[model samples]
Target: MNKPIGDLHCHPSFKPCNNPDISDIWTYKKNIHPKDLFKGILGVSPRRWMVNLFVKDLATYTQSNLDSCYEGDNRLLFLSIYPIERQFLRPDRPFASSTFVQRFILAQVFGIELKRHIDSRIIQILTGFSSTKVVDYLKSVYDSEYVDYFKTDFSLEYKYINQSHLSCSPNAEDNVATFQLVSNYEEYAALRNQNIIAGILTVEGAHALGEYNSKDLVGDKMIDDLSEENKEKLKASFIRNISALKDKEQFEFTPFFITFAHHFNNLLTGHAKSFGEAKNKSMPGFSNVFNQKNGLDLGISDFGKQLIKSHLLSRHNGQRILIDTKHMSLQARNDYAAIVKALRDEGDAMPIVISHTAINGISTRAKAAERLDTNQLDKKSYVSRWDINITDEDIREVFDSNGIIGVCMHDGRMPGGKFKDLLKSYKKRWPQKEFISKLHTQMFLTNVFHIVKVNLDHIRTLNAQIPIEENRIPEVQAWKTICLGSDNDGIVDPFDNFNTASTLKDFKTRVKNAIDMNFDPLWKRFKILDIKEENYRFFNENEITELKLGLTSEEIVDRIFSDNIETFLSTYFVRAYLEGTEN
Candidate 1:
């Protein structure tokens, strides 16, 4: 029997943006109708099969289609309800006359600026090759007069997912499976036993709590410029929208957590530099597109503080939705962590979550910035050092709170190790089928290694503070916090070998073999660095040797793929036992 896998962050509903009415999750070639062919010619719902076959690296195709997840044995899916942000499609600038021909066509069709507005080169590139449904959807969003487009979009997506399973006969004795959204761990466990693909809801950003304005203002400027009366009105809308989710009609199906920030400032908190590569020389035109300058490094807004204190962190249908600090700016994260700390001090413990993230390999956010500015980061460092990645401080906080870290699988977020080139060269020389799998396996393991190493380092630091005679943290415990959070179907560039959810089953087996074969090198690659003398003691030679052995076990590989996530759910994914009150 194959072991079931779990993805803490993924968007199974994203790729079908152009066709929400579709009955099945997987976009099968047979499902493509004659009308869709006509739509493809018009740049709406383009044939993804062509791209998937010809340009695998393009990654424009859906990764977490329901068919793929069910076939791949991915049972526990923490699906994200990301109300596609309008800012990405319609930015501050207008398009120039000398842009791509497709943009001109799309602009004419949608009656919106195709070039002047679109941010992110990746978005522009994907728009060119894939369906224009996202652009069409965004245009309609702009046309709507509703002040809470986010909530509207969020509800539409939830309903689409909910309705898709209506045709699924749960008791049927066929190979057919359904993606059912579970309320808590109890439902998930029940479904898992029957081989059902269970899904738990999670929103990618607090913007879903009604930050969207229909006026087409740039980023969160509307929030900043809102009149006092309007601010109160928006806040009231926020309360109503959030409350409805916990009402009897939706409580058992609402998101368990909402990511605090995303690509743009959501008026709740500033976000990290998610588009640093756009500023590079190769993408000069995109340098000014994704503007994070206004409140880029600033802390959370007043409205955000109120929302957290009064709604999100409070009881809603006898359960509280957790906050995810994935795209939050450094200052915002620091401020939020302080709040978590304060809550803990007050005898209220809340789990700190970074739903999908990579490691910066730096100790703190400030140090990451300094390293970037001075180009002092280790040249051999494989992981991307962007601020969007979690720092040592974040790992320590999550570890202390017994929170989980779902390491993301985007190539942009977590680049392969320094030996990437060497592995590629070996594959070229060997020209064997297995070499292809081995190459990608080693590359991806680098990311898993970094996260585990950082946590182990944190544990060791804690141990150093205690005397040699005193009890210390077990090194193996660090492995329990790290698990998969592949942001598939979230416009990510996936590794070629493990391109989609269907590839996960094979990837799991490959990971076990790679860990057993490459244990020593991976251990040395992520060796602990010395901390400041005043902060903590350095690891002794004996401690380092013992730590290395503890993490080399094959059990750690299983933990990364499934065990850790299941353990976390059993402990934290539960409703409050007390009598419930409405939000």
Candidate 2:
């Protein structure tokens, strides 16, 4: 592996959603006299990862100071927008049965990124809809009679909209200097090169659709039970009330928003050993007459199945596509497997691969999560969390599907955790058939110290085991996938041992010093910093510069870096979604 390896996941251009902190920071960057080039680049990069720097907790901006320093570079950024698709039977989600209500509530409750709790209330009302509580209240005043007509609530909608204007500024003035942001968004595809990847947008969830023929079913008594603590009760209430609102001629339930945590977690509950049968189709799935038993059945929602089916026809059309099944749940994977077989049966070739993984047969340490101690130090206690990794069965599926799985760096996705624990987590996620605890926010932020530690440990683990180069994680001595996925501009930690944009020289110097000594510079090796310094690469410019294996070889390298992604997009990505592909 002689090349200057790069990564597919890097967000260099992002912006803050309406917090006031940027004004000051921008001012500092602009005005800081005796400007140093190094400081300038470093200063801007952090602002990208941690938006907290751009806004005050109180939501005010320190603008005066920022205007002075940030006078130099104003790079237009390509930002991501979350389309709120999480509500759509998203795969690998633990709490599926409650996702619709939960995600909806969560979107409103914590989606302060786009609007405040109060503002969301207005959008609901003005749009002929309202929050769970308000909708319930309205149901009482208005019988189910006018429910289908959004116009029925025109008076209230107008009143709320008026109130919103009044609250922001005088009714006559639209010049308030307020900045705000949100979740559940749909970013324009054309904005990619602009340096943005607006987060996900919401696609129609199955639950959001009900029988289309019914009319006038959403109303009052339905409102009465809106606040019930019990989930099943709430679900039943929604189905009954919303179902009843329609005219008998038009009423049919549309399964929009989604629901299907329908299966039990046998692995966690001790009903099964590690995910032994974690195959696509072989795992949990819904059996309908349309599915032939032996075909690869990926457990997708009816909507997902359609999407995957369409995706396959449009993109794969017999071309190879690496389907990273990492984020998919057991059932979803199975569903896809079925679909794959069906495609093959029809003489359609579908080449797919699981991008990264490990073996499952290995026992991993418990505290293998990437975590941190109170002192911000890395510790090796494998708590119940961060121990989950891909399993052996997971690998077998990918392999059987003729897929490639990348063994990743960053300690099996559990940073700052012990090496052994990380290994165990990886094994589970890969060739094994069991699942592990997910990495939550606390573990993510707290695990910085362990990242640094694990990299060190990895170096020690294979000091005498493998060849000079492969020993650097990503090899048999150390298999690693692209670890740049969530370095998040080095703002968030657990990559405690990473190189800052500023001290890159020092980091590389240390690695070089150790190269000939037969010791490991583990974490350092995983990172790619300052592309100018090509020597750090196993096969840097010197090795690759003139070695013409012919145009095809160069073409292959080109394909490996950006071309593969392009090919992937050509095979599957909607050109409509190609807006920001370059970045």
Evaluate all candidate structures by whole-model CA lDDT and list the values in order: 0.64, 0.26
Q: Candidate 2: lDDT of 11? A: 19
Cα lDDT tens digits, model 2, 1-583, are 1222222221121111111222211222111111221133333333222222111111021211112111211111111111111111112222233335443433332233422332223222221122453334344323332222122222222222222221221221322321111111122234334322122111111222221111112211121222443323333433442333222232221111112111211010000011111113312211110111111112454534543454223332221112334434444555666777787788654544433222222122212212211112213333213112333334334323333332222332343234344545545654332111122212321221122223234445556566686544431111111121232221122222221222222222333323222122433322211111011123333322222222233343333333333333343333322222322
Candidate 1: tens digits of C-alpha lDDT, residues 350-439: 778888887766787767555441112323555556677877888888888788888776655664233345445656786666665665
- lDDT, model 2, position 419: 35
Off by over 4 Å in 1: 17-22, 27-57, 91-136, 141-147, 166-174, 215-225, 276-295, 316-318, 371-380, 416-436, 464-472, 519-553, 577-583
User: Alpha carbon lDDT of residue 87, candidate 2?
Assistant: 13
**Total clashing pairs for each candidate:** 4, 141
- lDDT (Cα) of model 1: 0.64
Residue pairs in candidate 1 whose N, alpha carbon or C atoms collide under 3 angstroms: 93-116, 94-116, 95-115, 95-116
The TM-score, computed over Cα atoms with residue i paired to residue i, of candidate 2 is: 0.33
Which candidate leads in lDDT? 1
